[model samples]
Target: MAEEKSRDCCVRHKKREPDQYRDMINRLSRIEGQVRGIKRMVENDAYCPDILVQSAAVTAAMKSFNKVLLEDHIRTCVVEDIKADKEGTVDELVRVILKLMK
Candidate 1:
């Protein structure tokens, strides 16, 4: 009932299993470190193309992280929402996908 009430309040926060939470946090931590490395490269006057390559690597890593999270959302949140017959979950999912595509 509390979960439903929260959803009705339009502030749904999915409860991630511990393992999933840890994995997501690990990915974000790696990305944060990569960003810090890029900042150091900039401060040290690293070559532009080399910096660009590293930037691209960071972008790819971020996309990979998004992919993992999206897969989990579909497997867990979307599945649970649909099973519960919560209204507009599919539409909300569509909006999210569209935003991601943009």
Candidate 2:
């Protein structure tokens, strides 16, 4: 078998206002930094409680990120889908909520 070459892709499908885009990206970047900090704490033998606290922080940050994104999706996608008579989006959102709860 020949070597499987990897290809790079630039798929820019999601369109958001500049401010919204910046806000979401900035939130994710902060969460990424928090995750890296947790990795460093683990590598350096940080206290278990301290690490747990930091882990909780990361989890909170992720939850906040999800909340923001979900709000945006509901505000734009869900609302637009409803307006456009695409009722499936509501069902899709219910599935998403169930998945999130689990």
Candidate 3:
């Protein structure tokens, strides 16, 4: 018979708290504005270097957002499962880390 999986071992994981979600949404909203601004800059024939700098800022903001979410996941879901010795939890975490690195 196939081995049973832990209850928490699934593709979908726990969600962030409302405050965290809101923070992410706010960051994304700013990024959306930045994207629109980039389009305007292109249309107005703005300096290429300025546009590249703004694009870099947007990328940094997105990476910051991702870091926050990853930290939360490690502190909450991954820690709890690892402490409890949940089946395949460590493996899953390692896989996620590898995927993120790539």
Which candidate gets the maximum TM-score versus the true structure?
1
For model 2, residues 20-93, the per-residue Cα lDDT tens digits are: 98998899899899889999999999999999999999898888888888888899889987999975788989
Provide the lDDT at 24 for model 3: 85
- Number of the top-ranking candidate, with lDDT as the measure: 1
CA shift of 72, model 3, Å: 0.3
lDDT of 3 by residue, 1-102 (tens): 133455444446567779888988999999999999999999999999999999999988888877887788889988898899877877887897788777
Candidates in order have lDDT scores of 0.90, 0.85, 0.84
What is the number of backbone collisions in each predicted candidate, taken in the order shown? 0, 0, 0
User: Which candidate model has the greater TM-score, 1 or 3?
Assistant: 1
Write down the worst ten-residue block by lDDT for model 3. 1-10
Compared with the true structure, what per-residue lDDT tens digits does model 1 show for residues 1-102?
999888799766888889989988998999899999999999999999989998998999988998898888999989998999898889988998899888
TM-score of each model, in listed order: 0.87, 0.83, 0.74
Cα lDDT over the full model 2: 0.85
Worst 10 residues of 1 by lDDT: 7-16
